[model samples]
Target: MNPDIYKLLIIDDHPIVAEGIAAIASRQKNITCKSITCLKDLLSVIASEQFDMCITDLEFPDTNGFQFIHILQDKLPSCKILIYTMHEEPWVIARLSELNISGAVSKHTDTSELSTAITSIRMGNKYFSEVFATLNKRKSTTEGHKIPELSKREKEVLSYLAEGLSTSQIAALLCLSSNTIQTYRKRLMEKLNAKNVAELVSKGKEIF
Candidate 1:
């Protein structure tokens, strides 16, 4: 093994799927690939060895993929993650973006696109499949008329509100003043054309 090689890990419940990804990754000259079929083996390998990137499937037999992303983030803060899944929901992509995931590709994408996604992510860029991009564009076009763009802080407040947090609770969580949180709430209602908090939460659920 080359000491300077980039180490990549592929995690999926399906052994053949994992092996297929590993096979593609191994074709890179400076890349070393390891594939594991379960969370336990993934955790063990992560504990013992450092990886540059991880390609993971969302559907695991025993664990949720979103929760696994959190675990991987905690364990390997510097390792980039690329999601490979059949899920193409715009909200799912939005949630991943909120969580700051490195990139995502649909399972239906070609191996060439997978290699492109890996290369882009490794070079500190986010990659999404064309389908994801197209869906997002259409969603934005339709929603733009009704919803104004939200600032980062406003989006945070809206997300907290959707989770049933009060102004005071959101303020404390975001380390902002109660008045500030209320102001954000008001802005959210206006931008989303919401009549009240209930409506605001409903609209926020759709977009965020």
Candidate 2:
């Protein structure tokens, strides 16, 4: 692989989807694209090669897509990740944003949006689909009216919590101590007026 060229990996279970992404990437003179359909192959490739970016689906046969994102970030600190999946849940999008992912486009979105996401992320900017962008804007507009405003860290905790991550797992991902995560958990519950984790998650979905 030439060091001067931009390398991209496309991971999707659907063969046609992977090929489509590769085809799109092939049009760029500076980008070289490779497609894989499973986690094993993806890990194998990452072990032997470096990539500038990875576009992946949110569901995999053996692992969660967000977990894959964490693994990729750990392995290739500089590689930008863009989620290209059909998942349009607000909580999912909020979690991605909380994780500081570079960009995302739904499979249902216009193909041009994927190109825009790739270009923006390559330039160190964040990109979200128009729907998500509008949802985020509405969230901002309704803050403190229908829903209480949460601090940045509180929102981060809520995002992870909605994903069913335990406090320890969230702590490890955020580089915080277990006690600190617990503190955040307690604060989140109080702020959301929830009696417990279930209620917290329930209220969180309504808020975010």
Candidate 3:
């Protein structure tokens, strides 16, 4: 859309997925890409370069997806974030809202939709693919209540935050805000009555 070229960084634990996104981005006009498949490498790569947008997977072998997003945003505040994940649950949608990510698309989403998402973020707009939109719609119908049983999204965020990802990184993966994630943290603490992050971690491990 804009005349300026966009630089993209992709963080996925899978080599195939990273390569696929890189290939697609390379073929697209006005865009360039760099991809990383490990958290250590991902951090180092971002530190060494600047990017206009970041497309990341939600889960990784070394770190939680949402936490990783938080880390990337903190390390590179100006970079727009796009979540490409297989998670399609309603709570996942709500979690993304909390993180305030720029865009979200399912791994199952077609290339056209993926292109549209990248374009939207590059143009300074947020995009949520149909799969994401549907999840949010379903979540809204359930109101803002959390089941006494923690949902997978909450557990993931909690476990990761406990593992040391800053709230900002968690926000990025969950497509939410650091503050919003803080809310989740506070609520989780209150629910578990853990009183602190360490206790929360212990509880998280017990639950999972």
Kindly list the per-residue Cα lDDT of model 1 for residues 57-142, writing each as its tens digit: 87665655776788889999888999999977554554565566788899987888898898898778999898877866676677
**Per-residue alpha-carbon lDDT of model 3 for 1-208, expressed as tens digits?**
2438788989888888899888877777878888888788877887778888899987665556777777877988888999998877655676686786898999887877887888777777999988888777766677642333586777878878777998889999889988778777876664554657888888667566
lDDT of each: 0.79, 0.81, 0.78
lDDT of 3 at 89: 65
lDDT of 2 by residue, 1-208 (tens): 6768999989898899898898877776699898888878878999999999999997765555776787899998888888998976544555565565787788898888898888888788988898777766665575443455678988899999899999899999999999899888876664555768999999988767
The regions of model 1 sitting more than 4 angstroms off are 1-3, 138-208
* List of clashing residue pairs for candidate 2: none
Best first by lDDT, ranked = 2, 1, 3
**Which stretch of 10 consecutive residues in model 2 shows the poorest summed lDDT?**
139-148
lDDT of residue 86 for candidate 2: 90
**Candidate 1 vs candidate 2, lDDT winner:** 2
After best superposition, candidate 2 residue 170: deviation in angstroms? 28
Clashes counted in candidate 1 amount to 0
Best candidate according to lDDT: 2
Candidate 3 yields a Cα-based lDDT of 0.78
**How many clashes would you count in candidate 3?**
17
- TM-score-wise, the better of 2 and 3 is 3
